[model samples]
Each structure stands twice: as C-alpha cells, then as structure tokens.
Target chain A: MQLSPSLTQLIEALRCQPGIGPKSAQRIAFHLLERDRQGGKQLGQALTKAMTVVGHCQSCRTFTEQAQCDICASTKRQDSGLLCVVESPTDVLAIEQTGQYQGVYFVLMGHLSPIDGIGPKEIGLDILENKLQQGGINEVILATNPSVEGETTAHFIAELCHKYQVNASRIAHGIPVGGELDLVDGMTLMHAFTGRRTVSQL
Target chain B: MQLSPSLTQLIEALRCQPGIGPKSAQRIAFHLLERDRQGGKQLGQALTKAMTVVGHCQSCRTFTEQAQCDICASTKRQDSGLLCVVESPTDVLAIEQTGQYQGVYFVLMGHLSPIDGIGPKEIGLDILENKLQQGGINEVILATNPSVEGETTAHFIAELCHKYQVNASRIAHGIPVGGELDLVDGMTLMHAFTGRRTVSQL
Candidate 1:
C-alpha cells in the first residue's frame, strides 16, 4: 500500500484526464516509468507549455496561442463571408478534415446548459452577437452537435441571425451514410424521416 | 487544420499514455482546456516531478524515491526472510492488497519476452541472484503471472533459487474464489484439479 510519494502523486494527477480512474492512473504511471520515461517527460513539458500559452482566439473563441486564430487571420476564409458556428475546437477539426467548407468558424466553447449556469454570456454568445451586428457575414451555419442542447443553441443563434437580417441554416439531421437503418436509434430515424428532401428533383 | 501549435503538441504528447489514441487525445486536450485547467496543471507538474525523481528501490527493485522501498526498509519485513518475486510494481501493490503475506518483494519488471530481446539480465535477474547469494532470505515466492512467459521466467528463477539453496514456492493457480464453475477456463480448471489437496487436512 505504501507506494513512492511522487508515484502516488503521479497516479492521483493522471486521474484528471477524462475517463481515467484510479486503476488506470496507476497503470499509466507504472507504464510511463517502466517503459516510456522520455515520452513521459515530453508529455509533462507539453502540458505545462500548453496550459501557459494556449488561449482563446479573439474572433472565434477557439484555442490559439496568438490573439487571432489561424483561420480567423486568413484573408481567403475571411473573404468568403461565411461563418460556421460549432460547440468546440474539436468540431472545427472534424469539419476541417472534410475539406468541404471554405468558411471561417465561431466556436462557442460549449453549448448552453442553463441548469449548469451556462447561458448566452457563458458560451460567448455575446461575442457572437457582436460579430453578427458588425455585418460582414453573409450566412451563419449552425453546425453544433445534434443533442437537445445543441438544437436549442442553434435555435437561439438562428433568432440572433434573424435580428441581424443575416441568413442562417442548420446542418441536416438524418441517418449517416453507409450505416444500416435497423441499427439506428428511434430518435435519429424520426429525424431522418422528418427532414426528408426532394432528392430526385435536386 | 491548423490547430494551435501548443495544443497540437499537447495532443501528440498525450498519445504516450497507454490506450490513448488520436480522438481520445483531442478529447482530453479540449476537456482540460474547457473544464479542468487546474487539474491539468497539477498533472503536468506531477509528471515532471515523478519522471525525474522516482527510482527503483535498491533492496527490492520496486519504485521508490529513496535507497529502498517502504516494505523493504522495514526491519520486521526484512526479518521475515520472505521475498516475493513479481513481474512489475503493480503486482507488488496487488499482493500487498491481499494482506496475506508479510514479505519483501523482488520485482522482475517484466517477464521473459525473449522475442523482444529480453533476457535474464534485462529483468534484473542478476540483482535477484546476488540477493539470494547474500544469505538472509529464507523463502522466495514466485508470484509471477500464469502466462507462458511468466512460467518460463519463474522456472528459470526456480533454478537460481536451487543453486543458492533457498526455499522456493509458487503461488496457487486455480479458479477464482467467487467465480462460477461453468465460467472457468479449461486451463485454470486443469490447474485446480492438478493442484487439489485434501481440504479436511489443510
């Protein structure tokens, strides 16, 4: 039961990672010491550097070391006059991987969770409203997740777009391509049916 | 896309932990940035401290920040003259949890792993043999895992124990106490049958 003091602290600190529990924390600590000390050192340095340097982008609220994020600083993306709003920086990565959208992004950092005290101001909705009022954006695409909070957030932003007289559209909700319909949940199936389009005409 | 440099480095560095993949790395990074900045900072500091300071106990080869581990440093455990051989420090923790043994430990750090270029010297068998030759230990319990490599390593060490004229024993391998009979594997069942003793006499 009496492990080394620093090893115990390592285990305790490793539990801070999402989904990592006590057993996993211990396992990770032992593994790093036994097999990957160099990597462990590098990870420690990276964490310290990132925690100190990484900050929210002034224009989009995505993580960046500079005042403005790379996407926001790009003239090409800014010239497009299109802004796709998402819930987190990872969503920006997910959308960027597709190479489909040429627009810049607005990251909310989180969805509105009223019970948790998250509201228009908490998720940077006030920043978003200011951007909308400035009037360079031609359209705002609500690409938040399909959860209930995401939907509510999209609706709220859509109303904001209406107030600014800018166009707004929600991303489609339906069965994913190449997935079997039988395995799909009822809520998703319902969304697929309700959001049907005139595909043949298009 | 172009993620922030520090954020990207943090995600890449997080991959060093066992079982964490790209998506998990990104999720952890975002979770830390958005929710647990304080925990992330603490983990960073802890990792740096542990990786630099923790070393193997000289007496038992388990992790410690000093010359010997807590159990190995204790006079009572040293007087017991019982040394338990195991594959890793975690195994030491596991055995200590049972509270059925009052012995010091000799951690092998790994099993035989010959295909991976591991040998007797690599797992600190040289150190173990030296301890056996020192003439204080009365019994050495081979508590390595039941896998093929562990068995091979145990057999190899049993020979070393024989040369030193030290008493050696292997821990019991059988169906777990709370496990159902139908769920026990064939190999474990065979071990149970082969190692069965007269319960009334025991």
Candidate 2:
C-alpha cells in the first residue's frame, strides 16, 4: 500500500502484543494515528520506562520496580507466617481480589515441566527453599492450578516444604461454588466426591 | 493487587487502545513483561517515533513522515489524474490491496456529520476544491462507505465537483458477489435491483 515508513513500522511493532494479529495491528495503528495520538504517546512513554526500569521483585518474584513488591515489603504480611505459592503473578491478583487471604506470596512464574526444560530451579524453588530455611513461615499454601503440571509442581514443592518441617497444604479442587453437577467433567466430579466434607455433624 | 507502579501504569496506558478492557489490558501487560520485552521496547520506540514525526501528507492527508505520501510522490500516480476520494486512510489501504486502482487519493479523514459540527473545511473539502480548481484531474471516484453519512458526504462532494466541471462518480452498491439472495438485506437488494446492468443484447 506504500504506507508511510513510520506508519508501517508502528503497525509491525503493534504485532508484538499477544493475541494481536496483522489485521488487529493495522487497525490499532490506524486508530492511534486517526483518533488518539495522545494515547499512543502515553503508551510509548509507559512502555519505554517500564521495559527499562521494571524488574522482578526479589522477595516474591512478581513484577516490580523496587527490590521487593509492596506485599512482600509489608512487615505485617511478612510477619503473618503464611506464604502462598502460585504459578504466576496473575494468580496473586486473583487471590487478592477475594480479600480472604492474609499472607505473602511466592510466584513460581511458571510450572515444573521437564519437557520444557523447566525444573524446581527454573520456577525459583531454590529461592523458596532459602526462604523456608530462614524459619519464619508456619504453613505454605499450594495455590497452583489443578492441571497435571500444576499438581506435579505442587507435589514437588510439598516435598521440599516437608524437608524444611513447614506445613504444606494444597488448595481445594472440585466443582466451583455455583457449578452444576451434570455439567461438571468426570475428573472434577471425582475430585469433588473424593474431597467431600460433612455439612452437618449429625 | 498492589501491583508495581510501572506495571499498573503500563496497564492503564494499554487501555488507550481500541477494544481493550481491564482484563485484556492486564493480560497484554503481563504477556509483554513475561515473554516479549524486546517487542515491547520496539513497540514503544515505534509509537513514540510515529507520533512525533508522522504528519498528514500535504497532498492526500494520509499519515506520513514526509511532506507527501509515497503514492502522492509517485509521478505516474499523480499524472494518472484519477483521484479516489475516500473517508479515511484505511479506505486508501483497502483500495490499494485490491491491486486494481491506478490513481491518486484524497483522504477526508472522516465522513460528514453535521450534528457533530464537521463541515466542508473540517473534512478538507476546501483543500479538495483548491485541487479541483487547479484543473488537471479527469475523474473523481467517490469511494466513501455506503452509510448515510458516507452518502451525504459523497453527494456534497459531487456537487462541489460540478462547480469545477469535474466528473464525479460514486462507487457501486449492491449484493456482494458471493452473497446469498435470502441473506441480503432489503436495502441492499433494492440497490442491486436499482443498479442492475444488462449482460447481453439478446
């Protein structure tokens, strides 16, 4: 189309975003040029700044500009003696939304997958072990997903927690709160039955 | 979630894009940080450069770093004297993709919408009038959309063409080639009937 060099470059660069294809990249480029130059400027400045300065939080392995994330820096959260292990930073955000948990978090950033060359060390289990060895946490909640990889990762971490004499418990997995029984899959239904709890003592 | 300041700002800035909601913004931010920092950096640089340097082409009003767009700068296209008037630069791209048109373009950048206070000057009709007055263009093809606003804008331009003794023609409207009769809307069917052309003189 003989598009301007800068316009073409902008479209090409927009393709870097996940789920954005060629058509979407073109649309986004045109939209920015036509409707929102200011927004384009702001996004550019933000991206440049973030990519240059933002780094992993040393304490929790989540994204942060500081040495430790806000939650990891809070003395009260650290003093709670409860650490939740998760697969990614997004999981921490989801759990925070629930507002029930009072603890710090350790983000694996990925699961333990040998085929992908990811192991305990890859998911920062070494850092987790170091934290546990310091003898502050009383319990470690395994909030990884219920997938096979998540289960294996949780089990491996559980073994490590046992070695440190810290209590390790897997988060419950079953049908969700409002899920229908018939619509639920066989594996989930089995897990629901296997993990059934008494509603009334009588 | 007590997200890091840069991460939070990146998410907020991402919302400036079209069709990106909160979840999509968060997902895009995380995806870039986790896997495509290089891409994010390139996108940032591209966006910044494009926003700063890309101005409207002096001749056609399409985005360009140069004074004239590549198409406008081409001697053959300029000499063809067949000007395609369209609502926006995207329309120019669509036409160029067809590989049929061999002409220059004049981008309105938007269709006429009187209630929105957009008049002739706003859509650069004054510039178009100046071009027509200079007297070299032979045909002005109105390739605006088939919407009411598009039609109104084309009609207004058509009247302007008559003042300068330039022939103006609107692009065809009717059922698409692969479209089904049953699936076609009444207005389009009516257009098909009204625009019907004879195939043979049998």
RMSD of each: 2.4, 1.7
Mark the 10 consecutive residues where model 2 chain A has the least summed lDDT.
A12-21
Off by over 4 Å in 1: A180-183, A199-202, B112-117, B180-186, B198-202
Candidate 1: residue A24 Cα off by (Å): 1.8
lDDT of 1: 0.91
Docking class of 2: medium
Q: Model 2 Cα displacement at A54 (Å)?
A: 1.8
After superposition of all CA atoms, the RMSD between model 2 and the true structure is: 1.7
lDDT of each: 0.91, 0.91
Q: Model 2: per-residue lDDT, tens digit, B64-114?
A: 888998899899998998999999888898999999999999999998998
TM-score of chain B of each: 0.94, 0.95
Question: What residue runs in model 2 are displaced by over 4 Å at the alpha carbon?
Answer: none
